[model samples]
Target: MIGERWINLAVPLALLAVPLYALMADEPFTITLATRATILALAAVGLNIALGIGGLVSLGHAVFFGLGGYAMGILAFHAQNYSPLEIGPLTFAGTKSMPVIWLVAVIVSAMAALLIGALSLRTSGVYFIMITLAFGQMFYYFAISWSAYGGEDGLSIYVRNGFPGLNTLVPIQFFAVCFVVLCLALALNAMLRASPFGLALNAARQVPQRVETVGLNPMRLKLMAFVISGAITGLAGALFADLNRFVSPSMFSWQLSGELIILIVIGGVGRLMGPVVGACLFVALEHWLGGLTDFWHVWLGVVLLGIVLFARGGVVGLLTGKAGPHV
Candidate 1:
């Protein structure tokens, strides 16, 4: 069997190569599909950092994801209309720049995570999950009723946001931007996993008492991890909205959060390449299975059951014959 390290390298390489091939062959749809997978994987990666590492099973990550999407939508919307966004005593203008949008997305998502994690981290086991879910649902309903930015109707980006030195309107160029961001995020994940902070957080997850005994605040570590996770997921949400050129309340739905967890489970929890592999399989299955029948989710459900019962290590584990951090 191939080693996990090699498989990990190969998976990302294949992801890039296929998109590059699509661009060369003028297969814009294929490129778009790859881009979708990349962005979804990025979001899942964020969830993995908290769930896989810190044992934080948050069903409300959609809050941050939606926040990020809305950040982009609202900014782009205002910019397109040449209007200012006013809140209370503050007045702000919008821009179509991708960097600006991403910064806002990250900051907003991180701040929300801080607030949510502070409250949610006080609970353990299922309580934490419920709190997160409640927050997510709250945001979903709020987005639907807000009505300022199209409310339940959602917001659309008439034009793709601008990226420095690139024509984002070009499918291939936009895909490249997303791909590079995913790579950078993956690199950060790898580094974090190996860092002292990551190890401490993992240790806290397994034995909070021991971590506390050693003078580290387990809750603080977990909160920090949650915040970072939320920020990354938020960044992915921004990219996803850009890819579709739209943002809606659905982005905050509980279903989206569930799918992120499913992706982590399918790819291999705690594994570095888990989200990448899971996202690819998800997109491929949806494409193939949807064409065959309307109940593709039923098949998806069956696969998830099998993984939970038989292949706890996920696709990477099955292929490598071992479960390691390399996943």
Candidate 2:
């Protein structure tokens, strides 16, 4: 218990410490990297709610990620062009407000998740996995063919969206914004994990039969988890688009979805702070090993293989002596 508690607090603080030191040392690039990791960690947190807790392995989460990106893209694109978006008969004006963009992203993504989950949850195991993957690919192709929003080339935001009081143009200020959101998401995850619904979800994941015996609808619980998961991931997607000032079909790619899952596995599946640890490690490798070799992914694969075979608990599990519950 002591070790787990230490690992939980230590991982996030260490992450916080690095960026602080980087800021003090005037290494803006490192701060950017840290911010990327924080955003990715936020996305993985969403997945953890469903994958880690609900036992739903969705390879199509990129659908929500891309949806969030497009939400930002479409809104900011119209705003930048000074045109109102016309949908059938209703004319919607675009605004550069970050809060409005985030709200739209969350709502749209949640709706998408609900629609997808309603159908996908009908199947289990390999079927569920394939169905999710299929849905993701469907969206990927749709984005590719939709030339109105840059099509294969992708969309770009001319400027960063507006925040209440901060100048988001500053790298550190943007980092602060993302960091606060990450912390809030972490708090939400902690709250959900400690709630009755969380217990029921975990039980449904572990033993659906028993959950059903208790009159709890496992499908409903999973669907709710999926919706919340999508909303959070969508929010991360909006941040990611803002981070790059661009959105592309690549956001909906299988590779990004796989990386999100890999983040969860490498950090510690189902463990709080697992995604943070995973994202940091991933970004570190991308920054360091990427510069050393063109085939850095091969090395990453080897390391992941070792973890899968040897340290199933990932970094947090290895350090804290707690194995991942799902695997």
Candidate 3:
């Protein structure tokens, strides 16, 4: 067990080093690519809590993601305009600090998840999936119609958000920010998995009736997981917007939600670090395929279909032996 834990921890840390090395080697392409993988993996980790561990199939996670991006975009717009986002007398503006952006993203996403989860949890299986997808589409359309922040076009930041002690514009420093956030998300997931609530959540996923019989409310457990998952994913969205120095309604689309789910599925459901491994593989495939051919997505689809049908367990499951306890 100790050996397993060390390996688990070491693998991600070693993976983290790759970006730094790429930066030192002046491999700008690889550095930026790795940074993206890190951020996406963090988002996947958040989804894993609800979809993998809690057994909730949420197809609308992009709602929270887009919300986070919009939070950053809107704030930056107001800041640049030197005007308050006003509704009558009440107004607010954006901040340049990453921490502030992260906090707002978390709060907004958490609240949205609470409301969405409450409604979606009323159903199960395919119904839940459809409802969540609908909610996501609702937000996507809203963004497209709302011209306040570039609407269908998008919003761009004049500069990347700042951190207190770091020059975020530097590629290495920005990668470090993403790396640290990813580590924090992983650590939080680990802690939650080991907690009693996590145990109940896992149980609720496998045996809701038994959980209820044991006097625990499965609904509440799932809802809590859903909210936390949203918050984590939202933070990733904030980082993503900063990475590109832009935000758009496209980020909230159903396709983005599908991709997040795909990451978890390809990584190995319910496994810690599975998302990280999967994100690395996914991004690498995209980069390589993009280089090889313009229609890489066509080939990528074939590969993903093969994994879904033949692999049964994802890449991690194939490598690690599936009989071990869930992460």
Sequence-dependent TM-score of model 2: 0.98
RMSD of 3: 2.0
Deviation in angstroms for 180 in model 2?
A: 0.8
Q: What is the number of backbone collisions in each predicted candidate, taken in the order shown? A: 3, 0, 0
**Alpha-carbon deviation at 27 in model 1, angstroms:** 1.5
- In terms of lDDT, model 2 sits at 0.92
The order of the candidates by lDDT, greatest first, is: 1, 2, 3
Candidate 2 clash pair list: none
Residue 21, model 3: Cα distance from true site in angstroms: 2.2
Enumerate residue pairs that collide in model 3. none
| TM-score against native, each model | 0.97, 0.98, 0.95
Give per-residue CA lDDT, model 3, range 43-126, as digits (tens): 899999998889998999999899999988887778777878886888777588889989999999999999999999999999
Against the unseen true structure, what C-alpha lDDT does each candidate score?
A: 0.92, 0.92, 0.87
Poorest stretch of ten by lDDT in candidate 2: 318-327
Every candidate's CA RMSD: 1.5, 1.1, 2.0
Ranking the candidates on TM-score from highest down gives 2, 1, 3
Give the winner by TM-score: 1 or 3.
1
